[model samples]
Target: MKLHVFDTFAYSKTGKILHFDVLLSERNEVKAHQRAIEWLDSIGEQGATIKPRGCTFCHTVADAPQFADEVARNGYAIYKLEGCPA
Candidate 1:
């Protein structure tokens, strides 16, 4: 499966910038934005907001087995880039 990658960044409540990628099987901006927020919330960044400008379509790539498996279980998968909690 081909996955659409959305490069997303947002500021946490503590003013730390978090960089991550939202990968989806389909290219839907709305869904991508929602997924970004969901991931932020999951990582205890409930106060972080993913503005439309913050999340932009980056590129599409063939899904790896791990990513494909995760996307199948969840609606989307996130690839943490920077400033994300371990």
Candidate 2:
């Protein structure tokens, strides 16, 4: 299986910056992309998607704009500032 990392950042309820990341693997890139799409579907604009395992930073993009299409390449999905581990 190929490993993939998805990254993003959002603010906490207390105003602190919360950086989040999640790692997933699938048999191929097609499956990986599908997995990412499913995850995105599970979490709409008003919702947040939490990592089931690996990292546990909790995602909550309350007012941020859509980012997947503009930032991802080769099935990698990313959204936010640099330096977050994925």
Among these predicted structures, which one has the highest lDDT? Answer: 1
Candidate 1 lDDT over 1-86, as tens digits, reads 89999999899878888999999999988899999888888878898976667998999997567799899999899998999877
Evaluate residue 85 in candidate 1 and report its C-alpha lDDT on the 0 to 100 scale: 78
Q: Rate the local accuracy (lDDT) of all candidates.
A: 0.88, 0.38
Please identify model 2 stretches exceeding 4 Å from their true place: 26-86
Q: For every model shown, what is its TM-score relative to the native structure?
A: 0.93, 0.29
Task: Flag clash pairs in model 2.
Answer: none
Candidate 2 residue-wise lDDT, 1-86, digit = tens: 23344443443334444344433332343443344444444444223333333232233333323434432433434442433333
For every model shown, the clashing-pair count is 0, 0
CA deviation > 4 Å runs, candidate 1: none
Model 1 poorest 10 in a row by lDDT: 43-52
Cα-lDDT of candidate 2: 0.38
Q: lDDT score of model 1?
A: 0.88
